[model samples]
Target: MTHYRIDALRQTLVLAAPSDGLPHCTFWGARLPDGADLAQVAASAALDLTGGMLDANPELTLCPQTAAAFPGQPGLVVRSPDGTPLRPVFTKAGTKRTDTLSLAYTDEDLGLTLTFRFAADAATGIITASTTLDSDTPVLCDWLAAPVLPGPQLADQMIDFAGRWCDEFQPVTTPWATGIRARDNRTGRTGHEHFPAIILPARGCTNTGGEAHALHYGWSGGHRMLAEELPDGRRQIQFGHATASDPLPGTRFETAPLYAAFSDTGLNGCAVSFQRHLRDRIVTWPQPDTPRPVHYNCWEAIYFDHSLAALTAIADRAAALGAERFVLDDGWFKGRNDDTTSLGDWTIDATKWPDGLTPLIDHIHGLGMTFGLWFEPEMVNADSDLARAHPDWILGPTTQPLGRGQYVLDMANADLRDHLFTQITTTLSTHDIEYIKWDHNRVLPYNDAAQTRGTYDLLKRLRDAHPEVEIESCSSGGGRIDFGIMAHTQRVWLSDSNDALSRLRIQHDAALFLPSCVTGSHVGPRTCHTTGRIHSISFRAWVAAQRHMGFEMDPRELTDAEAATLTKVTAWYKANRDWLRTADILRLDAADPAIIAEQQQAADGTRFVVFAGHAGTSTQIAPRPLRLTGLDPAASYTIDLANREDISSLSRGTPALKSGPLTLTGQSLMSQGIALPYDLPDSMWIIEGHRA
Candidate 1:
């Protein structure tokens, strides 16, 4: 039999591999500076080693759980409990190189992780790293109860937010997820489901006034992970590669790559998700001051007849219905609306805004509405005025192999950051811009400047400059929609996919861990950029309620009836938003064909149950009339009769469910708790039950 040993002395952690075949590894200078309790420091290191592995894997090979929990002389070891050697012997393993580095250790049996902080009384704060985990057997990940689970308050916030997500209408009701996975012996990776895990992003970081470090968790690279803290107290995770063979790219793309921060995660980088998890816990959710308009938009209006009159006409229609805000989207920006030309120029196109955007603004405002504008300030056209004027200003690589994009700014440079910041700030501050829909068209085309990583610094600087702007982040749509992005930005366009049914899936999955205000649902047109599926009028507003709702279609063409429905729904959201905003969400079940996650928030004596779902009620037997989990049933209450269609259905089928009394119970009828037979597809019922 082979054995493993680990020891923690002050800031040093030494793992001694069995002489039989496993090699031992020693890591020193592992303690936090400023002299922590030496014993506590040692215990912390041991725990980090034990738990880090366990956090990543639940099924263990050995009974190292107890040993890791109480590390001293022999330390702790993990192996297959069924006496199967999980990994092969690696008596002499080769060393590897990586871009970034961090370390994490886990207990195999108990499934625990012990993430190390600073080394105890260590010499260098810069942190040097080394490790030796043998190539033995595969360990199945299972980190159910790690010390770092976001606290109860954060968890509750997530549940509440998730409930709203569920409440949004989804045709399939079942939580739908699609992802691409690599095939062992295939040409391309295939998309698969039944996910082992998922990543949910609420809003692209809403620029809250705070430190950059606070939002950061870890970085990835070289298989090593490093975590860091910015001056403002926000956390960031860094990633490093796991091996030393080849230098890894620091570029951010969606693949299994290493990231690093400064934490004790030794994958050459930090894990991609730890800081994101932390960010999800701390950001504050701000409700909309005014009920936003169920707007129509046009990025496609380019070359598709987006004249000022057409746009005003759209605004006119939206206004007639009492919508609060009307946004004149893209094509209006200086010479834009195509894959080329006029990007750096932020002026309005006279060709498009003939009466000067002021008339449109005045008219929209005259109609008792605020006006919004869109800007893709991150990129530049190779032939734009800004590029031609200040050629050196654009970010470019000195050497060859520069990726795509004709013009990119040097965001890392202070002058450039200030330049771009001033431009955007000036525009946003100067105009009747009640709302600024900020979009980042691309991640980064090129950052090969000898100076610094410009794009990220530029964003951080912009966040600092425009703290109060109601900014929306759009990297295409789903890109960069992380807590880091949300910390500075208020809302994120949920997806380019605005089809209400599709939104049900995107939003239901998104809301589980995001703030309610972070979700962005646009009352998209009959067909647009994503999915191209048109939605019913009712389903549009039903799902849009998940987050800040807007319009993504041409406002002018909506039928008077469509406009009226929009007006009514907007009013409804405005009237009772308080209930939805502050309620606590309880995810009732995850396996239903239509997953049910409900929210209950109390303001006065009224308790609101927001039943968020994926599929309509037809999946189950009228859900047992939804025997609400926490309610004083005997108390008198008034179920909001807002759902007339539901009223009609109950009257016809479930005749037992009468409004006058709480004692209305009927026998199982032909109609289960499904949406009314002849009602709209995605509708929300604000059932207000009170302690009568």
Candidate 2:
């Protein structure tokens, strides 16, 4: 048995290990901040807010229970709700968790205690972590842990604050049979319901409700999350939590998100994900000179059964639109349709491109638009030439464990890496390849024998060999987006999902972690990648304005009038490019009851606002002169013509001129309040005002 004591008056909480001594897994000293009430800290900065990294050896930051301020001392006094400040200090050595950390908060009044726990799971060689909230008061158990991955995997723990948390080492009876019936050992209550522990190896596992709550389910990575309450009423989990594989051990290992998640609460979870990634990986962006994409991309028309004539059509269109770069997506290589076959053959397919890629690239460059090509270099099909040619190079044992599935190329083997490098690098150097979109489709699968150390060098070698080439990352659409990848690539594909409403959150979360200039959000048409249902065009326009805007649709499908509008918007974006590229964005709620998005000045005294109406609802936005955060209110400025829907509509419709107050009270929905009779979801008014 172990006993714990707290010196509440002095402001220190201490824990004791079991007297008989528990083997392995050492725990560190625990302390609750002074002036911090355990109850409040648990909600906002509980265990979920704390983090552990392979880099930071000692120092730790934790969310104490909510009480405002917490005093600091090596050993003082603190109390728990049950008067048992059982802050257990452990020292488990020679075990899997070589490094460890823990944080917990308690409050007698609210009967709440918040706690966070994390440590390296050396056995799995990936970090195994989790978070939980405890209450002496009545509530179900709330907890979450990193989901497992297919092969050897890393662990991540995501958490949301704003409540109390407590560590629960206390054992409890798990559910019996299939029902939520468990024995509450503490309360002696039978048939107690508790949230089932999440089980995820491929994706991050999540759970919540300080009490039992919702069943965990969602697409694994690269999306935003709505705040969800578990079946238990005691806890809630939102986005802003992440985990990563043990960075390929090297000087340049990164621990940031390959896929980021943003929260509905407006928290920039992507930023948090990457900031943590920086803990392990080297950040190699803004490569040397001022790095920027030479132009936009048009890959759809140029991908499938397109001839030189068809490709040139896209090239000509991109040039007319002032796009300086054109990228050729899939179908250039020999035999690639679905994920079924035709990889590893980097050679140009004679059937599609009898003249090779150089001619099209040469044609593009001749038109002043640089050429870029796509390649999934890391993955190969079993029937591909590379695999057929060198069966031994595939990752497996000599005994031939080919029994279950197809073979995998062992990047760990120097010979394999060098061979693949020769093929890929030769293609890049032979042609004037300026940009490369490196994609990886599947996760790694190394049997016990086929693996080796130093996998991180794969990217470094590829990039060092061709430093001048700008790379864009896409893993079947962003499963590979991360700072480690960003070090070499110029930008990343945000998502394959081009729908606007979906983009609002996707782009919002993506930009939070990545800079707007480095992003390539496209102004895709309503009939986007999948659904093909046309959404509010304004929504596309708004999402496009937030980052380095482009489009993914066939320009031929749009009506002449819509094309003209796109041209107009493109022109305006180019003119005010600095506003978004170098501005601070602050979202405000408009009087229209819609999501009011606004951007402050970039390099000047200009401020812009976008007021998007609710889906299918026509609403009037009451003009509120926002106290611009980063603008000079004393200076006078003129609002641009395209920014005002009133002016743009009048200029488009009546061929008349009209000027009124900053507030568009008397104007019609199309004029001032930006309508959504359909889903004018991206309808807005960009207001550039006089500083005074």
Q: Which candidate is the best by TM-score?
A: 1
Candidate 2 weakest ten by summed lDDT: 183-192
Q: Provide TM-scores for the models.
A: 0.57, 0.57
Give lDDT: candidate 2, residue 493. Answer: 72
Write candidate 2's Cα lDDT for 329-446 as tens digits.
Answer: 7667886654556677778888878888878888898988777888876556776788888777765543444321234466567887787778878888889887877665544443
- The list of candidate 2 runs beyond 4 A from truth reads 1-295, 337-339, 391-409, 443-456, 536-539, 590-641, 645-679, 682-684, 689-692
lDDT of each: 0.41, 0.43
Residue 65 C-alpha lDDT in model 1: 33
The prediction achieving the highest lDDT against the true structure is 2
Give per-residue CA lDDT, model 1, range 63-111, as digits (tens). Answer: 1233223121111222343533232222222222243222334334433
